[model samples]
Target: MALNNNRYSCPYICPSTHMQGEETKQQETAKIAVKPENILSAPYVPGNVRPRSPKVYPPGAPPKYLPQPTESTSGDILWMSPVGPWAAGHIDWSPQAGITGVRPVVDKYSITRYSTGEWRKNNQFTLTPRATDKAKALEAETQKDVANTFSNLDKKLNHSNEMLNDRIKELSYWKKQVQSTLNGITEELAAIEADRQRLKGACKILMLPEAISRECLELRTGRYEPDLVRDDAEQELIKEVAIVGEIRKIFNDTLIKAELQIEMIKSTKAAIERDWSDKEISLKIDNLNYTLTPDSNLILAHPGVTRWPENATTLEYWKHYCAESIRNCEDVRKMSAKLRADLMTSITKGGEDMKNQANRTNSALAETIDATEQMCEKLEDNLKDNLQKIADIENLIDYLKESLRNVQERNKCVMTRLHNRNYERPSVENCRDEAQYALMAEAKFIKESSESLQSKLREAESVRSELMKYRGELEKDIACKRKSLNIDKDRCARVRAHMPTPEEFAAG
Candidate 1:
């Protein structure tokens, strides 16, 4: 519709406009003029309402200017949309439109055309290609990441398998070492046991020799006095007794050593067995682990299986433990062997010593016996000589007695003659006559002879008594010597002969 210029006027004029009325009117005319280059033109339409000027207010009040719409400038009218298409349909700015009234005709084509163009420009040409490229790049990068992940996982799995295999081999090796040590310990234990038995046997054998030596000493005590001497045989017997005792003690000590060694070997064996047992279990576990795969039925999610054990040992410690155990076993075995050797040596040496001592004792006894026999023979000879001397002294005493008897008979005859002369010749004959003197001299000689004979007889009888006493002593000494010989040669020698052989002692 065309708008009339005279329909509305300015309510108030500027002072400059009044002062230059023609210029103002020209400017107003210019303001409403339309260029002919405008493309679309709307036809003018007549309205019943008369036009009027804009109202003016008092001073300081606002003055309102109303520009009249004109039909000639209708082509210059441009519809400026202030809202979106959806909202445009709900508004009507025409004077004939009411507050509640919406526009009867909607321009849906323009909005539809604009929307189609935006879809073609932004969606198809710009955003779609950019999004496609981004998706392709993301897919490629994801595929590469997946390939790297798979490769790393495969490498890790292979490394784990190799480690498991190595562990299995290590377990196998240690197991074998432990088994070998166990065997050595077992053998050592057996040897030690045997040694113990031998020691006990040796101890038993020593008893026989010790008892025999004591018994021989006891038997020698029965000797009679003067022949009961601590002879060579006795001394050797004492030595043999002492040696047997010492050998018994050695056997006992050796037995103790064997027992102790046996105990040590047993302990070592137990430790090796335990180590072997652990290795066996570990071997089985490692083998099972090696056999497992992703498809294995035994595979399960063992929670916390990756955690390390509290008592886990390092490889160095493990190797050291095995080596130390084997070394200990070797040491124990060596000790056992040494003990056995020493025991054998002791037994052999002991038996030889005892036998040698017994032989010595036997030799001494034999010498003592020979010496006793000689002594007894000498005593018997001395006894015979003493008896002979006693007999000769008795004969001398008898001879002296006969001489005394003769002297007594002569003295008696002389005294008878002297008595007859003294009576017949009286005093003169007693004074110094030749016949009287001769008779007195004869009497004196007879008295002297008788006194000498009595003295001889007494001396001879005392000599005979001494010789007889000497003969008795010699007889007693010979009997005592004979008794000692019998005791030593018969009783003690027989007892010593029963002494065990060196082989028997060693065997025990």
Candidate 2:
């Protein structure tokens, strides 16, 4: 019988038909084969061989055995036979085995099949459909986070823009205020310059050197001269000459008038004495004749008639009688007494009238003297006051002259300065023209500057308005962006809840 290598084998030995007739011989061969080396050399040993363990075999089945094959002498079978289904059924598969030939074919087929089965199992149990959905969800959350961050950045940019606009507005407003203030200062400066020019003109008009000179001359020449003394002296001389001549003429006239009156009275007294003397002599002669005649006739004397001497003249008798009568004269005494009384009365009355006239003259003279004295006193007082005033005025004039000299010196300096400035005499007309031109230029400059300032102020105001408008728009944009950012933040919060946590990523 031919043996098939696929057939299973047991651990028991059986006698071969070919080996039965040779059994006695085989027994001796077996006994010799039983030796240690011989047994080790046997392809299969009998009882000394260890069978395949039951753990590797099925229960109640024979253990499979494999023989070590020898090399064929002929080159007919070059490739080795594979360990078959027994090994396939009993041994665990190792991916490390480099299978070849039929074993490789079987191994590849089994490995393909197992891999397909494992892939199907993993698809079912290890990796679920929810994983793809989770990936998509995570991608969406990342997109949302990106969008929210971008939106927040946009809002920040908008807020920065708004703040810049506000700053620009404030700057523009301040620029306008500064421009206005500058314009006001410029106008004030112009007004001050105009006032200064006016004051300069007024000073020029009022305090001119020529006017001061004329005034000084008038004061010095006209006001404080001693006019009263010369005038009074001239008047007094005229009056004294006239009054003294009049007084001398009156004295001479009065002396002549008194002399004529005294001479007339004396002539009249001489005539009266001469007439009395002539009458007394004729009366004595008549008396002598009458005594002679009467005494002779009376010789035969009556007893009652007184006796006279024979040589007694009538004149002597009469003379004696007259002398006796004159001695006892009461009539002449009463007449004399009456005349003396009249003369005394006339003289006393006349003297009293004269005395009253003299007294009035004296009083008039006293009044004149007092008036003259008072006038002199007043004049002296006036002269003294005038002299003091003149002295003061002279001092003032001296000071003024010194001042004028100083002023002249200063003017000379000024003139020298002007000359240096001009290099020649500057004509009044030319100076006036230059001044007017300068004033016109200044006025024009002021006007133009004012206009420029106004224009600048207007421009500043316009810029301020534009800046304010920009600020307002920026504020609105900031508000809108902020609102959008707030909405994005809310959406980002919602997205964050489903996304992977930072701690989960770390763990993963």
For residue 258, model 2's alpha carbon misses the true position, in angstroms, by 18
lDDT, candidate 1, equals: 0.71
Of the candidates shown, which would achieve the greatest TM-score relative to the real structure? 1
| lDDT of candidate 1 over 54-153, digit per residue (tens) | 5333355321222222211111123323343333332223321222243332465543212121223333333333458879999999999999998998
Candidate with maximal lDDT: 1
TM-score of each: 0.46, 0.22
Candidate 2 residue-pair clash tally: 4
Model 2, span 1-508: residue lDDT tens: 2222322321123223453355445435434433322122224446654544432223453222221112111111212123433123212322112321122225424532122222333344443445588899999999999999989987876676566555455434434443443343344334333333332332232223223223322222331222112332233333433433443343344334434433433343344334334444544443433344323653354585577868666756744643443332323333333433443343333334333433343344344344445544554555455455545544554554455455556556555554554555456534645645555555455455555555655555555555555555544544443333332223322332233222221121
Error of 2 at 247 (Å): 20
Off by over 4 Å in 1: 1-165, 248-260, 287-303, 372-486
- How far in Å is the alpha carbon of 301 misplaced in model 1? 6.4
TM-score of 2: 0.22
